[model samples]
Target: MKYDLIATSAMGLESIVAKEVRELGYECEVENSRITFKGDELAIARSNMWLRTADRVKIKAGEFKAYTFDELFEKTKAIPWEQFLPENAEFPVSGKSQKSKLFSVSDCQAIVKKAIVERLRSHYKKTSWFEENGPLFKVEVSLVKDVATLTIDTSGSGLHKRGYRVDQGEAPLKETLAAALVMLTNWTPERPFSDPFCGSGTIAIEAALIGQNIAPGFNREFVSESWDWIPSSVWDQARAEAEDLAKYDQPLDIVGSDIDHRMVKISEENAFEAGLGDLVSFKQMRVQDFNPKKDYGVIVSNPPYGERLGDRKAVEQMYKEMGKVLVPFDTWSVYIMTSNENFEKLYGKPATKKRKLFNGFIRTDYYQYWGKRPPRDNR
Candidate 1:
């Protein structure tokens, strides 16, 4: 049976995530917050395996208006818990409320949990024998404008936990956000890509994986495996497809560097774990120390915004340093995602284009600086 699938993405990366879904041969109803599509269990598995920028994959069980606790309990009770969850599993309800009829979110959460527990107890024919403590089964309840919608979390620990970054440096870029930056570059495998302020080497690693067309889930395990109802053959099929899609022969120039030597070491280890050490290079150098060997390539970076690093003066100096390093590459293009517009003054020019992007709670601007390149004259 087809089920409604919701792929959760970061606030600014939603459009790119939706595009990635369409690329995978699925028609999605895209919105500002999330994208909805209809797929079976295999589709759900595929999404969990390949989606790079999504936060989680959810299976829509039921959605209805809940004006009171009784309505919430009754609607949640109707869900067939035995179909997806094992008897030994714990189904914990998690949710949010905003300008809704059920103003008390805690009360709503309790009611929903009670309903699921009631269903599970009835299904197993044991009032108190079923274990309430197992791997968590997440439930999402959204109370928006006084209407309630609910769904089941099929992807646990979020997709950002790519299972490679065991440690992080100061203000390291998130793997999902780094992947989104790589996507915004429109870079093919033919072009060079580099990140200078590559703390923990997230952008560099993500770019290398994309260039080689590696599945992000290759090194990771997923929560979908916990569902006893899905056949083992289906998961095997999905994994086989993932294995076949791995690419090792592509030549790519993906590189990352940081001022910290330890960060460079961490990046190398991460690449090794991802089986991409040979495809990516990590160096210990500051932005000023970098001099490109190639003329035209893509430079995508998330430099320190000075939030936890330093004061405003140091941030301005950092931007100035970036400007100096980039001034000579007329054919090259650069994209900087930061929360500061003072970057314009420091760079001594206005960006050709700016897009609104959010990095968690900090609203950011994605500034595209097109280096001076004379228009080609077609004779």
Candidate 2:
């Protein structure tokens, strides 16, 4: 039951996702936005249930080059569809084409769907139309520079949907991206963690999860759970492993604060929804009022970049205030995500390092200011 598994990530988080995959005991190949590895059913369950930064976990069915519709059909049909899909499986084909001869996405979808139906019909010896009333198997055919890759979606909703966040702010960050931001920081459970712009408390909650080593998808259900080919015992074993590994007794000093009282309440509600209310705290406060009580702490914030009209001046002033208060804490590492090009000028200092990351479609820079490392004995 070895399968080629691919974990898709955000535009710039391939390395982090690949690191996570390797940590999960799988050797992975890092591509632009996907990490491919050889795995089995247990790997599928473990990947969907644990990869905090991946968007989706898919099983790569096949890959080939296609120049025309006939070639597409034949190449697609050559795949052993019967090995994956059952007779009554509700498989839907989605397609996207880029710089390829098959420029028509809808046409490619239709042709692929027809070819899969032909293959299934021949395998099952069914003359009537497929009922498609059984388990779901979502399929995608992506064409990049005339090379086609076909995959089956194992994660129903994106992994960012951790089934939490009953409420959110107008510009809340994604759960996956928040986790990535926390992972990028030099933070540990023994140190204090804070997010000044705690929209929906995503970063703080993700930190709490990381601190406790809890599986991100432990409380969520995935689409592949309904597939009959994967035994329930496999999922149970994965869940059992997750439950056994979680350090629930580990205390975390994590906090999230926001200027808006409404957002503060929303953050608290979302944190509780994620089962992290006891481990993390949320409050209403402005970024200027933030003061860390612990040395060698970490601050990761996703402040408003003033992408909207007339908010640029306010955001700039906020950045200046962030520099005024947090920068002077030489023992605290600070990380900020913003799209402003003049962030260093506004923040009053150049960053130790900067990384280019995409927050959805907005191009942004992650400004990192390294702080003094704690003494070995103190650490």
Candidate 3:
């Protein structure tokens, strides 16, 4: 059966997630942090198993405007929760409100919970209390401008937890964000890719996944897998398709390095866990020492942006050194994400293009320095 699905993303990556959804053959409506689309049970399974940059995939249960507690309860109860939530389903209500009459999030959550429970109680015919011993259906009630949108989480954990990267360095980029950075670049599998400040090797591993056409969620599980409404055969089919689509034999030319030896080791471990250890090379080296032997490579890094005073001076020095090392590679493109406002001045050259992105909650800019294409002979 077709369902309204919403793929949630980071604030700046909605378009990317929408593109991914479209690639999956679904037309999507992109909003601020979420992309809503029409899809069937298989589409939900496919999205949960393939979307690399989305945070979570949720089923849009219902939407309405409610100004008062009674209105909220009645409107929420009007939704056909029985179709989605089983009699014993453990559905917890999460809530968010903005610019709405019902501004108390806790009250909103409690009201929604009561409404759903009431609906379930009526549907099941005799329910003093639900067992809640079955699969989880995490419900979210979000209010914006007095409009409430209810959704059920299909992905139990965030998609960023790809079950890889058992360990990570300090301030490691989220897997979803790292995947977005790689997708934003023009790097192809044929071109060399490097991340000089690769913390726990997120970018490199994501690139390897991209290059090899490996589904990011292939090795993980989603909450919907346990939902009886979506037959297990649907998930089995999605996984089989993912396995068929992956190019395990594809050769990848990706490298990641970090100044800390321990981080480098962690990067290797993460890559190994992601099943791309042989495809990505990790090294213990500073950004200044990075010198790619291959011409016409791509450098995408999330370098250190000193939030502390003591580290600011050293980070600025490192930025300057990065300019010294990378500027001379006229044929290699460079993309760096950092929060420093004066990154361009310190790097000694203005970016060819810049895009605003958020690395977590901290606002940052993706400095893109486009390079001349390699000679035709190289191609």
Candidate 4:
């Protein structure tokens, strides 16, 4: 049962997702916001359980070029939908069109739905209307320059929902994005890691997960788990392997702090729910007061952007304070994500390297200041 799978990611994270796919022993092609790969049923289960930075896993059912409604219908109908969707399946078609002949997204969705229904009806042979009492198969039709790609969503909920963090602070970072921020750094399990502005402790928790080699999806479920096309034994095997591969006994040096006491409490609760109760520490403190005792540490933070006009002056002052406090630790690498255009100027030091990233539609820059690695004898 070889299938084409697509792991969708944030706009700037396609390469990271591709790296994850390749690490899973699958060949992948990296696109703008997705990675297309070849795999079997086990690959599907494994990917859903292990990819920490992907938004969702989908099955690429078919792809073709279609200019007119008739062409769209024919091309969509040509796909073997019966092979995936059972007679009682609840399939809902969604669509998007961009710079294509079929500019109307609703019309495209309706046409695709009709084509799939007709195909299923012909294959099943006794269908007036499908009961749809079974598992859900969400189908999506995307058109770009008149090329249509049909896919079925395998993850009902986005992978960012790791079943933890029932509560969060204002403007909480997505778990997927948090994992990506950790991956962007050069931090490892041996190095101390801290997040000064840890809103709900997403970055610190993600760092702990990385250090322990824990699968982000270990505590979650995916839509494809109930699909008839995939065997339950495959999922069982994948989960068992994930459990065996996890390094629960591995040591980690991670901490998170926030100015708000309530947020600190929320971070503790989330960390406990993530099964990292004793592995990571959380405290309530201002960023300027942060003083790590270790050298060659890594500090990654997503701080206030000062988007409101009234808060601009205060946030600028905070940034200046951060510069003053952080400059003394010349041996610690600092990574900060912020939407402030003048962050470098306010921080009083230019970043060694800067990368453009999006923090939930607010364009931000990741300022990286590489610290010199400690000598081998000290390490």
Candidate 5:
């Protein structure tokens, strides 16, 4: 059976996620931070396992207008929840509200839960409480202007939890955002790639995965794997497709470096954990000292923006050093994501283009400096 699915992404990455969904052979509608599509069980399995920039793969169960509490309960109950949830399903409802009559999120959550329980209880003919010892069905109720949209989370953990981050620095970049940083650049598998602020090597590791066309979820599992409706054979075929498409033997020129030796060690461990230790290199090197000999290389970094106390002076100095050394490499493009508004002045060069992105709660700008095109044979 085909189900309506939505892939949630970061604010500025809706188009990117939509492009990926289209690449997966699905027509998608892109909204503020969500991409909606229709697919079957294999679509569910492949989306949960392949979408690199999405936060979560959710099933859009139902949507309708709800003004009163009674109306909310009736409308929610009207949805065919039993079509997805089994007799022994353990469903927990979460909620959020905005510009709606039901301003109380907890109240909305409770009402939805009760309505679902009532419907399920009647369908299953259970006189007692649900045992709650079964596969998990995470339900979410989001309200906007009295219109409620219900969905079930297929991804238990956020997609950024690719199951390979053995360790991370204090301010590590999210894996989904890291992959977006790479996808936004012109860096292909043949082009050299480096991350100067590779705190946990997330950027480099994601690049390696993309370089070899490996599925991001290849090393992880999703919550829907336990749902009986989606058979093991569906997952098996998805894995088999991933295995066949992966470029395990492909060569990647990727490196990650950090001034902190501890972070360097952590980066190495994380890369090894991601099963790309042999394909990528990590080292203890300052951003100012990184000297690239190859032309047409791509440099992506999530540098310090001096948000924390006592980091302003040092971060400014590093920015100056980067400006002095890197801006002259006309043949190599540079991309930096930072909250520092004075980055252009400190870097002594204006970016060719800039795009706004949010790193968690911090608003940052992605600075792009496109380099000269490589020779025909070199490309």
Candidate 6:
């Protein structure tokens, strides 16, 4: 059935997420921090498999302005819980309230949970004791200026857990960030791409997948696969679609390098695990040693931003070395994701494009540099 679905994304990644939704042939209405769309079960499955920038996909159950506890109890109970939840399923609710008639979040959570449980008890005649063994029930309650909105999370775990990167070094980029960096570039399998500071090989692997058009969820299983309502045939169909998109014989020139030999080894292992060893290459080399190939491509990296690796001075030197190595590739476009405010000074130029982003709790920025100016005619 068509339902209101909201895909939550990182602060600055909302536009990218909206683009992904639109590419999937869905009409999305963009909001402040999320995108709202209406789709069926297949849409849910597709989002879980393909959305690289979204944090969670939530299904709207119901919404209303509850000026009092009594109104909240009645409105929440009216939501059709049985259609999505089994008679024997156990569910819970959690909420957050601000500037609303109901200001206490804890109280709101307890009330919503009680209302849902009561509705299920009467519908199923489940007067006896019951245990909650079904898939996790994530409830979101947002009260802004006295209006309350509730949604159920279809994805138990965030989509970033692609299950391939079991091993990671210090300050590794999130899988979502890696995927975003790939999407932000113009790299294709016909050309070459490189990451000089490829920690754990996230960017290289993401690029390989992008080149092959393989679904990001190919290496992992999502929590939605366990829901009783979604049939196995649907999942099989999605898997088939993903497999059909995979081009095992596709040509690609992707390389990852790191000064630390151990990180290089980790990257190799990850590529081997993801079955991308043939498409991507990993090496233990410093930034100065990397020589550009003939075909034009992209260089995207999440370099260490003076955190844990060394002091501020050493980090600046490292970025300088990175710039020294990257500046020689006249045909390549370089993108750096960092939390350092002085990265522009280190890199020696104001970015052609700068976007504000967040890496977990750290406020970050994505800096893009064009190695060569475009022709006057093109401009």
* CA lDDT of every candidate: 0.82, 0.94, 0.93, 0.94, 0.94, 0.82
lDDT of model 2 at position 14:
98
lDDT by residue for model 6 (1-379), tens: 7889999888778889999999888999888778999998888888878887788888988879899988888898888877777765656677788788899999888888888887887888898755787776677778878888988888777888777775899777888878888887666677678898998999898898888887887777776677788887878887888898778778888999999999999998888888888778999988878787563667888877786555778888988877777776777788898889989888777888988888887898899886553344242
Worst 10 residues of 5 by lDDT: 370-379
lDDT string for model 3 (107-215, tens) is 9999999999999899999647888999999999999999999999999999999999889887889999999999998788989999999889999999999999999
lDDT of 1 at 28: 94
Model 4, span 107-160: residue lDDT tens = 999999999999999999955888889999999999999999999999889999
Cα deviation at 93, candidate 1, in Å, is 1.2
Question: Mind giving the per-residue lDDT tens digits that candidate 2 earns over 1-379?
Answer: 9999999999999999999999999999999999999999999999999999999999999999999999999999999999999999999999999999899999999999999999999999999999999999999999999999999999999999999889988787999999999999889899999998998899999999999999999999999999988999999999999999999999899999988999889888898898988889988898889877779989999999998779999999989988999888999999999999999999999999999999999999999998999898343
lDDT of 4 at 255: 94
Q: Using alpha carbons, what is the TM-score of model 4?
A: 0.98
lDDT by residue (63-91, candidate 5, tens digit) is 99999999999999999999999988989
**Model 2: how large is the Cα RMSD against the reference?**
1.1
Residue 42's lDDT within candidate 6 is 83
Candidate 6, which segments miss by more than 4 Å at Cα?
A: 307-310, 372-379
RMSD list, candidates in order: 2.5, 1.1, 1.4, 1.3, 1.2, 2.4
- Local error of candidate 4 at residue 357 (angstroms): 0.5
Residue-wise lDDT of candidate 1 within 1-379, one digit each (tens)?
7888999887878899899889778899877678889888888888888899888889888788888889989988998866767778877788899988898888888888788878878988876766656666788788887678788898888888888886788676778888988888656677788888888888888998888888787677777777766676777777888888877788999888888899899888888877788888999888987788975677888887876545777878989988887867766778889988687778766877888888878889888876544345121
The positional error of residue 361 in candidate 5, measured at the CA in angstroms, is 0.6
